[model samples]
Target: MTEMVKGYNFAFIDEYAKREIRRKVLKAVSIPGYQVPFGSRELPIARGWGTGGLQITLSLIGQKDILKIIDQGSDDSVNAVNIKRFIEATTGVFITSDTLKATIIQTRHRIPEEELGDDQILVLQVPYPEPLRIVEPEEKETRRMHAEMDYAKIWVFLYENIVKWKEITIGARYPVMVAGRYIMDPSPIPRYDVPRLNNARTLYLFGAGREKRIYAVPPFTEVKPLEFEDHRFRIENFKGKACELCASTDTFLDEIILDDKRMYTCSDTSFCKKRGNNPRVLKYIDRNQQ
Candidate 1:
């Protein structure tokens, strides 16, 4: 933690609200990819500004928990810095930019490039929680579709994308089938990060404050992106380009233009720093050494 504040509870929320949120989180974990409704409480921050994830983190955090907050894979960004300050002030818990040291990581928009272990919990900030909403507008109709496991319309949506663009045009928020059951919107994570969700060690918790929804993906769960036989799902390819700073070819690279020249860099800042400092990481696998 940066520094502890005198006023406020250990985790900033009352005991009653914490218990309720915990119960809802358990239900979401029991049924993977199933959206569980909860009573979203008003926080100090605005509703659409990461309140859902902040709420979940507040509910789950303990004294021993080392938290990490990131926005779009950066630690020093405006959103990340503000959220980190809020969390450390309220909880007084240890905060780290090092991905491996964090027991609970609250993130928006992007998952860390380093693989998370079973001991870690990743709390993702979701703007929208419903995957079926793309095809069905009403809440009742979407609930019915989930209950019956009817996903023909969403399938048609994908099929139509392939028909027109010759590929899946979804840039982010890729719809994935969780545990071969419910189709979930993986919270705007890119296609590159989609593959990391399948049978991973980390437990993923998604919170949508505005939507009053919470969902989870437990350890070793099967998460598959929607794809066909011929037109298979693919991640963004850099065409042999590597990160300009880290020289990492295997990890995801962000395209940048410096002085009218194309440059590629690692979106995960910690990953870039780790590789840039270590000479033995030539294998290019973005894993935490510690």
Candidate 2:
């Protein structure tokens, strides 16, 4: 067997990739909600494991900034923990559990419960940022179509979803009105996090590495969720169950599989640990350790 290493790898990504990402981030910060093209490089982390988020974090993180990463809104989740560990190893910057203390938050799937201020920046990992992806699969066609503001196809698509499903089949990643013209994707932050976007003081940025696109929402930017007069934009139904750990009725809960029975449960063990400190997460930790 190989001997144990003395320290962690200093290379999460190369300098060239970090510089390219930094350039894209600068453009994104300058032009809100505009998709800027960048030459994205391959990283050690896989595509689905928040590589985009990690890129943004590496580019933006200074020695002064405190970073917080959460997957499904839990800092202790394996994905979140892994990302956090990677950053901590590379940058040696602070890692925070408190939302308010974090200068930058890298999130997947769910947004934090705490309201972010103007000082904070949120970096979202987007699997697919295009709202018209379902309607128009061709990248070349969609780019030209977006340039012309030809979203007639998207409206028809939504209309058809209603016609067939009786309701919009989109669970998360619901489309939103940006600057009263562009219909943008809120990066799958759950519909609950969509409302938090409107007129918020924080800068929201979206990154999709595989798609090679980055977009932004400026502070106090106009963000209106897509809705009909008869059918309003709503969050995923939890069926009136509080978080098993935090007893929070307001936050989103992850669906659990227990003995083939479905149940809604909180996946944020950090949040749960703050409350009565649920034992399930602890048990999971113990099992993993063993």
TM accuracy, model 2: 0.85
* lDDT tens readout by residue for model 1, 88-177: 888878889988889999998888988788899999999989998878889999999999999999999999998998888789899999
Cα RMSD for candidate 2? 7.1
Worst 10 residues of 2 by lDDT: 278-287
Worst 10-residue stretch by lDDT in candidate 1? Answer: 281-290
- TM-scores for candidates 1 onward, in order: 0.94, 0.85
Candidate 2's displacement at residue 128, Å, is 0.9
